[model samples]
Target: MRFCVSLFWLLSISSLYGQTAREIVQAADSKMRGNTSQAQITIQTIRATWSREMTVKTWMKGTDLALILLQSPAKDKGIVYLKRKKEVWNWMPSLEKIIKLPPSMMSQSWMGTDFTNDDLVKESSVVNDYDHSIVGDTIIDDRNCYIIQMLPKPEAAVVWGKLLVCIDKKDFLELHTRFYDEDGSLVNTMNASDIKTMDGRLIPTRFEMIPAGKPNQKTVMVYKAVMFNRPLDDAFFTTEKMKILND
Candidate 1:
């Protein structure tokens, strides 16, 4: 009788810990994206032969709306990408055209960088699209972290088969993430570092995405400045607004 009682207690504790892991994921994701945010960012693509950088201003509202306007690289200036709901549109100032990105193109690299269109638009939410579990604990960048596993739901319309994420236990910040393919092969890894106070919140100031097996190639995004929960009109997320906003 005592053996059976201990087993039941162990199982109950395991179930409760799983719930806590999911909550931790939710909290980390919320810290990265508030109700509304605006920021200046720079993306740098490093390669063996050459490297390039682009600066942009971004505005995001919840999980459904986002806008990015390229500000530097005279040739690529004035380009805009807008995300509204599940659709994403691109405005090319040179071509004088607005192109709607199709579902098939969601996996393509954005602006010739390691980040895909889905990454920028965030078509799926980690908290809602995956089952979370606490795998173990590790230290990353001197911060003790909870290693969490995220398995995609059967009906989730996402490309990643699984994700291994490390969240700082103290502040619930994502310190690193490894993405796997449908075949369960590691495809890419993202590391968040250089933590500091930005816009009144403590977070990672830089993120680096490195493709598996490519030691010399990577993409880095650095946050210049950010403001969370700012007042932003819904109309700012429309395609028309994307074309008109030259700044």
Candidate 2:
């Protein structure tokens, strides 16, 4: 009886010293404390036997909202994905039309990655869509991290039902994440590695996503030319400039 009591006290004490895992998960969704920034994007995707690359000029006021224009590989140039508030639109250069992305499309294939189009452009806030509760604390990549599980709020319009995210204790960078479907089946796993410098920020240099059911299947993305807080003219986000890249 004494041993059991001692163990309980030890557990209670540990909780007092540890940060809730949910806080780490929220770090990924939290908005930056500043205004917009322009970033030069370099994205390379590979899945199974297929490989492709794309370049984009992106502008984001916050992590959850952005205007991204595709520029690369000689074919998919001028394609724009814009997220404003709760709505997301995609402009196809071939069709010269803007179409609103349906929630169902968010789960569909995104380029070659296991992530859906929704995953590629995460312009929605986790705070607004889901409730985060810290399950426990864990060590990820030798850094103390919080392992938070996020369950979608009933009123939230997002698709994913749950996500387990591991966040760094110091920098709050997302080290790893796991996604699940509404039925609670494991769907995909995402990891970021190879830290690099761009625009003076030490962000994830490589992003990899692997589907749960597929064997030997994974998508890798390398981010380069990451400029931070660069001044961009308002004209850059206009349809006129988008058309030039399309032409």
Strongest candidate by TM-score: 1
lDDT of 2 by residue, 124-195 (tens): 456567777666678867878777778887887776879888776777777788999999999989998776
lDDT (Cα, 0-100) at 227 in candidate 2 = 55
Which residue segments of model 2 deviate by more than 4 Å?
A: 1-23, 30-34, 231-241, 245-247
The digit string of per-residue lDDT tens for model 1 on 86-111 reads: 78899999999999988778778889
Question: Worst 10-residue stretch by lDDT in candidate 2?
Answer: 25-34
Any runs in candidate 1 off by more than 4 Å, and if so which? 1-4
- TM-score list, all predictions: 0.95, 0.81
**Candidate 2 TM-score, true structure as reference:** 0.81
